[model samples]
Target: MPEPLGDDLVLLFAALASTTQAEITAALADAGYGDLRPSDGYLVQHLQHGPVSIGDLAGKLGITAQGVSKTVIEMERKGYVSRTPAPEDQRTRLVDLTEKGWAAIYATRRARAHVNRELRAALGSGASAFLDQVRHLAENSGALAALSERRLRP
Candidate 1:
């Protein structure tokens, strides 16, 4: 069998991913976000792009419609989102971000910047640059393209 990557490398990558997310979440909380989680951020970011049906959000998030509904309900309770009947389809409701959601998203963006600074300090310029380049490469790879296709397909 081909040699596997070193355990240290695998652990490093895992730690990096976890730390990045934790730092961003902490940053969002610091900026006045309540009931914040990575999933919540995903919902806000997608809704920020445009209104979406619960089914679409569930598909994008790789979650069940029931799970998405639960998350949406929590967000609604926290005033981060609101549901409005879709004009095109009265049977469907579109989830839209409220002012609170916008604020939460903005705070999360700022927090991510702070986390990026920490990453720069920890990884140094060279490793950081390499990570960025590799991320772009992976994002453009066939695997990612296939995943994206799956997401867009009905």
Candidate 2:
């Protein structure tokens, strides 16, 4: 039988994920976006290209339609996003980022870059290899595909 996955490996993955979020959170806070949660940043990033329907957002985020709706509501309250009737389909509402939302997105990008720089400095020579391994795992992992399949199911 193949060797079982080590608990340390799992913990390392979890720590990496949380640390990245924490770094982003700190960056946002420094940029006067302490009020925006990680989820809010994600939504803004998705809307950066243009407006999209709630269903489309749900699909892209691999989240439930209800979950996307709730996030949109919170974003609207914060003036980060706005909803308007789609001209092509009045029944559908399109969500777009506001000027504040664009600012948030820009800040997020800058914060992410800063975090990356910090990580590289901390990791020194090992940073590139570590990043490559992480990227490889993320791209080859079946977990995301399975999650998407489950979410798409009725």
Candidate 3:
């Protein structure tokens, strides 16, 4: 028997995610969007497709509705997100990303791409297989549903 990855996959992925997050943070700061946090990008991923209710977001994020509301308030203050009354129901409020939020999204994408390219270049052909295997595992484990459903979580 042989181990191909040499160590635990969880640690590897965590390190990679952290590095990419740092790059994203620095990139956003460089682009004049210092108010955004790396975690903020993940939190608002539901808004990428369209608006979502705070209750729905709470359920999706595994947090309380009150927590979601507080987060939305902070994000709105930071200019990354906005809350509006749902037209269909006056009692419901919907959350969506603002123009500034979109810029952070782009920055995150660019930073992740840069890291991917760097790893690909360093790993040569093995990088593709490694990535493919990771994706395959993610899909089989139901983890990829978040990506397909336009959801992002920790």
Candidate 4:
């Protein structure tokens, strides 16, 4: 017999996130915007706020600037994003969502809502409690700051 999986919070969260991502991907694929990946989704979410420099995006996403640049290059090629000289600093490029990028963002939002409804239905009365726990974890865990610090270290 196979060993039972250990109760690890990181693993639990990763598994849940992966499942949710797969659902979102499938829904987007069905909607004709399947070219987007999970990384692209993150980029789109960040761009939704406003244009940001690649370095800032890298910091926000806890990734290397090179990695963000690579993803941005691909997105730019696909017309999902546009890079322009930063008004305050010509040397820095600010990335913004193109029209297609906005469409992708809207599609992702709709798909996410659908998945949330499905999860709520499946989880029943416990769904709200689970969401509250997740919200608390995200807001107070300092995990993002830790990740950013770790990524910034040599």
Using lDDT, give the best candidate's number: 4
**If scored against the real structure, what TM-score would every candidate get?**
0.77, 0.78, 0.83, 0.76
Better of 3 and 4 by lDDT: 4
**lDDT measured at residue 101 in model 4 versus the true structure, 0 to 100:** 90
Q: Which is superior by lDDT, 1 or 2?
A: 2
Q: Given candidate 2, what's the lDDT at residue 18?
A: 94
Q: Which stretches of candidate 3 lie over 4 Å from their true place?
A: 1-6, 150-152
lDDT of each: 0.78, 0.81, 0.82, 0.84
In candidate 4, what are the lDDT values of residues 1-154, reduced to their tens digit? Answer: 6445566778878898899999999999998888888767666767877899999988878789999999999999989999999999999999999999999888889999999899899999899898888777865887656544433221
Better of 3 and 4 by TM-score: 3
> lDDT value for candidate 2?
0.81
- Which lDDT value does model 1 have at 34? 46
Cα lDDT of model 3 by residue, 1-154, tens digit: 6456648677778888788777767877887887877667557777888999999998888789998898899999989889999999989999999898887788778877887788799889798898899899999988899777756665
lDDT by residue for model 1 over 1-154, one digit each (tens)? 7446565655767788798888787777768874777857666656867789999888887889998899899989999999998999998889999998888877877888878777678777587688777677658766467554444222
Instruction: Please report the candidate that would top TM-score against the real structure.
Output: 3
Regions of model 4 farther than 4 Å from truth: 1-3, 6-10, 133-140, 143-154
